[model samples]
Target: MSGTVIATHGLRKAYGAVRAVDGIDLDVRAGDIYGFLGANGSGKTTTVRMLLGLVLPTAGTVEVLGRPIPKAAREVLPRVGALIEGPAAYGHLSGTANLSLLDAAGPGGSRRTRKARIAEVLEQVGLGGVGKRAVRGYSLGMRQRLGLAGALLRRPDLLVLDEPTNGLDPQGIHEIRLLLLDLHRTGTTIFVSSHLLAEIEQLATRVGVLDRGRMVLQDDLATLTAPTGATVVTTTDPAQAARVLGDRVLTSDGERLVVRGSDPAEVNTALVGAGVPVTGLVLQRPTLEEVVLAAATGSGDRVAA
Candidate 1:
């Protein structure tokens, strides 16, 4: 009933004295590729589990697709698909057979077209031909694809994926990214929990960064990575360009200069007019990784003496 497909406030999860997820709010808008970012031990998995009602929160609330979790899990979860951590299946069963069993247990899928749906999803995830292969014989990447096929079996409106590309090779990862983008184009709201900054940087419209069980930053990716009023100029004559720019120059390497100006066009004009050879000029923007690192503390996976 709200604009946000996933909304949380003060969401917390604790294991005895250890607070796995300290109070954090997550806002995932409809039609957003919301990238949930965190270092290891940052509680991203815990938060994701809570979002799906797999783990109970010690405090706060989680609403997915406008419904409260656990209380409304039966109704809500059917419309939501999730792949948490990785996936599991009967090693003895073929991928298709495994999906058949999973599909039968769920309520939303119609038994009449279950086989057809399974086949469709298998194809969607690049496992169509291998659906008949025993899961034990499938490679890790194939298993991952089969798991994704399972998640998309019912065509849920919201996809909550945790490291969806885990164990995938470069090609497999690229294919999955394309698939996710295609899904997003068709109106599925995606909440991706991943540590792969490069993938997230390419896919996410909004990003939330977590560090040591706390949310350090949450904003539109564009806002977080916006230009910092600086222009980067690459020139064969860096010294001459810097001289022409004067105090506007921030830093200079052998061939590139960081200028204290937001408009690269203006800088380019000045350089060109001053007879300085400008090879390239562009606005300097912080990358998604830079913004995330600036927000979050050091990785929690580290143990220092």
Candidate 2:
């Protein structure tokens, strides 16, 4: 966990002529809650599967926890916990019983440690009081929490979750977000995949955007959501302001000037000095959703500093 917790070089996965995951490279740092974001069918889940050795890459290399993947999956996977797709549990079984079964079936599991581990995880997920409740009676959010608890049983250094909040309501989503934040504060490196830009914006330290099996962007959330060189300036005399601003002016409707990539101070000074009375000016900062949309659609030239 000193360097990259997950790294991929030229990763590819194809079926017949369809490439679900094209050649892509990734570097997920230790302790980072890296969001693997994309639209539906953008290969986010495929990428996570490759990392967990659940799906074999058609070509290229993968390393997880500093060890080569698939080849070292046996040695590496135990240290990495995952909750892919959704909760895999029996509806008829009690919450405690389900966790016990899954853990016992996994490698290194033993009857001696199973009970304590189950109780510990149930409490960690806020399900301690309902440990004996049937899974069929649990809400979707509760089930999600239970799934997360199972993944945490190993106390893995890396936790990989695919669309963790797929169908949750607002409250459920909020609960999951809080849980993820708590885990992150405790120093778990989380690699979560989701199609919702807003969801990722809330929790990811860094983001990797995918589109149609190809990676379009990867950077810090701050870097990706910075100002995009757009500004709005209002003046008493719009015609005069437009003439003074010249080509830097993107648009004007005889009242305000929509300028591109110019400082507000400079714009005000130029307008006032040119005999145009400046009324108001504001610099526009692009939102995370805007940036994600631009990148996902391949319309963005670069992220503004």
Candidate 3:
């Protein structure tokens, strides 16, 4: 609870000659919305499996909640909730029925409290009104919600979700993001694995980039997107601003100029000293996209010669 929720040391998984997951170290601390990013075949899924003890590593170690996985799985897994490779349930069963059966099968949540827990999770996933409706009648988005509901039924301390917003429309995606943020505010550590950079940028407090089975980068989102000691100035006459700042100006597009300095106040004072009227002053920070592009070579699905 106080330290890492999930940690990996030199984790590797190889099939014959193909190394699906090469040497990689993962560090996921409690209270972190850790975004696990990679392209389609970057071994992201494999790594998630290993962390959850669904798949074994070829070499190295994995620990979840400060306990070694698969070794102490019986004791540790109950505190973890996951939606991996999507959710599966009997298509003929109602969402409530499916959850009831799952809760009965899993540890915790007694038979007496099953109904209340199911209702809570169903409502949490926005399916509170789908009373007794067969899952087969549900849409892909609804099924995804059902999957998430299952993961949340346990009120887990850690949530591992893969492409959590998959199959949802824009509004649904927005709702899920808000739901996740709300959960984080209450103190659940979340590990979200997805290629959706925009969502990750919005939600993740920390991120880890995977490329060709290797961990290329892992750090806090704030650190990754920290200001690059550059300031952006918006002025009517960019020419005068650039001339005022001289070589300190990096680029000028439209009314905006990118200047090579961290302090906006200093740049503003310099521009005002030169009689350059400034409309706006802002700091230049790297976007999550820019950070990932620099850390990982091409995406997971990049074609090679």
Candidate 4:
């Protein structure tokens, strides 16, 4: 929970002529609820696969739990639990049976303690009541929880999840979010990939954004979502204010002007000097979705700043 738990340098992956992940450097500190964000086909999944040793990187290096990955995968993987794509399950098998099979294939989980561990994770993910039900009969939400429970069975130090809330309803999504928070509180370093910005906003202590196979931004949630010069200035006379403000105006209605990259004091001083009555000035902060879209589209130079 102190040093870097996951580190990557110039990480890249290519297929034929396509570069799925370009030269990138990333760091995930211990005990961080790190949210990995990107549009569809933005190499988020590919990056994760490389981290887990499921897919080897074509260039650069990866380290997880402070050890080189793939090389140290034998020692590193046992301490990590992951739920990628979706839960792999036998549709005919009951939930408990599926966990039993997975635990058998997994590393270092003792048979004697396995029963109690499985029950513990099932209850943690709110699937205790349905552990005996056939997985095919459970709802999509239930299946997702079961997948998460399977991951938790190892009592991993790092939990890696890719799009864990992809197909969940509102209630299910909330439950997962709560579960993740609980895990974070218990000193688990969670690296999660998701397209759901609001959900990420609620859970992530830090975030990394990928756009077109390149990392555009990575920072703490608070700084990344902080206000970035999109301010609202209200006035009695919008036309006068616009003329005084000149090119600083972004958009203007009859009563207010939404200006960009201008200080409120500067705006107010200019308006007052020009004989425009300033009624109010309020700073409007950009939302996480706004900042992310801006960076993804190359419209924002530095969203976090």
List the candidate numbers ranked by lDDT, top first: 3, 1, 4, 2
Measured over all alpha carbons after superposition, the RMSD of each candidate to the real structure, in angstroms, is 2.1, 4.6, 2.0, 4.6
Predicted structure 2, TM vs. truth: 0.82
Lowest lDDT 10-residue stretch of candidate 3: 296-305
Tens-digit lDDT track for model 1 on 1-305?
A: 23989989999998999989989999999999999998767799999999988899999999888889868999899888889998899999999999999999988989999999999999999988889989999988998998899899889899999999999999999999999999999888999999899999999999998887888899999999899999999999988988899999899989989999898888888999999998888899999988877665344442211
For TM-score, candidate 1 versus 2, the one ahead is: 1
1 or 4: which has the higher lDDT?
Answer: 1
CA shift of 227, model 3, Å: 1.2
Q: What is the lDDT of candidate 2?
A: 0.85
Q: Across residues 181-265, which tens digit of lDDT does each residue of candidate 2 receive?
A: 8888888999999987788899999999888788888898888877768778888788778788789888887787789765899
Worst 10 residues of 2 by lDDT: 296-305
Residue 154 of model 3, lDDT score: 85
Off by over 4 Å in 4: 229-283, 299-305
lDDT (Cα, tens digit) per residue for candidate 4, span 1-305:
57999999999999989989988788899989999998778899999999999999999999999899999999999899899988889999999999999999978789999899989999999998889999999888788899999889999999999999877999989989999999999999999998889999999999999876799889998898777677789998999888877888999888989987547887778789989998899787777898788777673542223
Each prediction's TM-score versus the true structure: 0.95, 0.82, 0.95, 0.83
lDDT by candidate, in order shown: 0.90, 0.85, 0.91, 0.89
